[model samples]
Target: MTEVGILGTGAYVPDRVVSNDEVGAAAAVDDAWVVRKTAIRERRWAAPEQATSDLAAAAGRAALESAGITADQLSVIVVATSTPDRPQPPTAAYVQHLLGASGAAAFDVNAVCSGEVFALASVEGILARSGGHALVIGADLYSRILNPADRRTVVLFGDGAGAMVLGSGRGARVRHISAHTFGELSGLIEVPAGGSRMPCDPAALEAGRQYFTMDGRAVRAFVEDQLPGLVKQFLHEAGVVPDDVRHFVPHQANGVMLDTVFEQLALSRAAMHLSLTRYGNTGAASIPITLDEAARAGAFRRGDLILLAGFGGGMSAGFALVEW
Candidate 1:
């Protein structure tokens, strides 16, 4: 069986950098409070005119350039985003058109923060069973959906995009991936309106239910309790042990969450790759963006073990181990 791997990787953040101090001024917290809570000193917010597709296109082009492939070479383009530019037309088609990838099939994935791992899993399935390359992009302009008045949610989200080219390969390739969801426990966090369950209406807008909300206490407890065991299960299932793993790229949820998981699992920062300090929690884009940055920083070699893990809304989690 031919193995699938990332041929190239790319990521893009908006030019505007909003320091924690800036956000604190609006949200009634200090910079140090934000930093201590999220480990985020700064984050990028999209310009008022910018949208998710714009960031995804930029990241896609960079991935294509790094892969030495043209837009025409892509067999598929999967965009994973929770915040789409329009509620109607899929963002993938818009991105595909902008990139001039006329022949490539395009669609969107909406697994929220677990989106990239899901996109990567989908790509692996397509490539292993067939023979084509895919450009998977995870982009989110989450700030658009945020309620600026809500300190808890708004402070944790930023806008960014990350992409990777996956194709059949021999070295430093994706090997095993899996996804699990606990939909029954989905109430930990979510945007109550804007979807079918509670369609956007004038009433919904007035109530301010359209913005993202989370039970911080619930989230903190869940991560502290469930995440470590989940990581162990994923690594063991992939036939790798904790000691064999080289880089632990987890969902950039927050520093507190990551620190809790690490401490519980007895894992060291030396075993992890992180970008939360600069990127905040970019939802689905977190893992890929972190992966791209780390690779550029000479974080891995061909035989190193790379573990991708995420736990997010829908009470969902995913993990994958790739040889790199």
Candidate 2:
């Protein structure tokens, strides 16, 4: 069987930087308060003209360049996004057109913040069976869906894109992957008025129910209890110990959640990678963006084990063990 691994990686963040001070000003809080609470210093926001597809395309192009491959070589393009450019045409198709990957199959996956891990798992199955290369992109234009007045959720999100090229018969290997979802808890964090369940209406719009609503305290409690077990189970299933893992990249949710999981699992700060302090949470794009930065910084050498875990709406969670 052919092993699948990342051929290249890239990320794209908008030119504009929204610091804690700006958010605090907009929300009637202090910068220090926001930073101490969320551990977010600044985050990138997409330009008004740049949609999710545009962000995905930028990162895709860089991934192709890094892989020394052309767009024509791509056989599949999977974009994971919650905030699509529109409700009809798939964002992945738009990205494919932008990259001129005319013959490639394209589509979008929606699993909220767990999107990238889900997309990667899907592509892994495809790559392992078929003889083709895929461009997997995680992009989110989260600001478009945020409510400026909703300080709790607004402070935790940003806009960015991250991408990786996956191919069969690779030099490095994605050794194992596991993902799970609890649909009963999906309502805990979601846009209540966008889809069939909560169809858009004049009333919904008037009440501002169209934007994202999160039960922050509920989500924190749920994740703190469930994620540690899921991650540990997968690592043991992968036949590796926590100490053997060279890098641990969890979803860039917040410092509190990050610290909770780390503390519960007896994971030292040395075992993890921290990017939320600088980039905020870019949803599905978080893990890949951090992975790309760490890779560039020579954070891992050959034969190192890299552990990735993600949790968010669906109330989904996933874990992957990669050998770099």
Candidate 3:
């Protein structure tokens, strides 16, 4: 069977930085309270002119440059984002245009925070069939959907993008990839309106349905209950023990949540990669952004065993084991 894996990676964050104090004031909370709750000191917010595709394109260019490939060489483009520029067209279409990847098959995927991993799984066939490469980018403009007054959801999100160029039979071999979704818990995090069920209007706007909402308690409970088990299952499938893994790149959910999950999995501090403090949770872009930072820092040794785990809204969870 043909092998498909990452060739190069890239990430981009908006220039506008929002400090905890600023966000706290908007949310009617103290700076200390905000920090204690989300473990985020600050986060990036997109400028009015910048949209999700702009971030994705910036990251895509970096990834392509890293891989020593041009946009036209890519056979497929898969973008995962919850906050699209508009509802009518898939965000990938704009990203494809921006990247000048006119020949690539482009589309979008939304599995909430698990989207990047989902996009990876979705594009395996393209890599295999083309016997070449594809670009998988995870970018989300969460700030666009946030309700400024709702600190619970607002403080936890940032806007950013991460991209990876994957080639057929290449670097960082993917040993296993898996995902599961708990639809019953889908309501835990959502943009309540603008969809077919509840079209956007003055009434929906009045109800604040246009902004994203999250059931913090339910989401916390769900992650505490399900994520660790999924991680264990993933390791089992990869036929590797937790301690043997050199890195555990998990979703940037939060400091407390990630620490708890790490403890439950019996993983050590040295084995974890975290970027929450600097970026908070960039939704689908979190894992790849974290991975890119680590790679750029020369954090991994050749032949190292790397594990990627992500879980979030859609109550979705995904894992990928890579031999670096």
Candidates arranged by TM-score, highest first: 3, 2, 1
Per-candidate TM vs. native?
0.96, 0.97, 0.97
Give the winner by TM-score: 3
Better candidate number, 2 or 3, judged by TM-score = 3
Quote the positional error of residue 145 for candidate 1 in Å. 1.4
Question: Which 10-residue window of candidate 1 scores lowest in summed lDDT?
Answer: 262-271
Model 1 Cα lDDT, one tens digit per residue, 1-324: 567988888999999998887777777887888888888888999999999999999999988887888998888999988888888689999999999999888999888888899888887888888878889999999878877766787789888999999887543588689898888779988989988999889999999988888988898787778888888787778887777877888899998778778767655433777898988999988998999999889888878888888778888888888888
lDDT, candidates in the order shown? 0.86, 0.87, 0.88
- Mark the regions of model 3 whose C-alpha exceeds 4 Å error after superposition: none
Q: Which candidate comes out best when scored by lDDT?
A: 3
Candidate 2 local lDDT, 1-324, one digit each (tens) = 668988888888899999888866777777788887888989999888899999999999988887778998999999999999988789999999999999899999888888898999999998888868899999998888888878898888999898999997654589999989999998898998877877789999999988988999999988988987887788789997777877788889998678877877655433688788878999999988888888879888898888888888999998888888
lDDT of 1: 0.86
Predicted candidate 3 versus true structure: per-residue lDDT over 241-260, tens digit per residue: 87878899988988877888
Which structure is stronger by lDDT: 2 or 3? 3
- Cα displacement (Å) at residue 138, model 1: 0.7
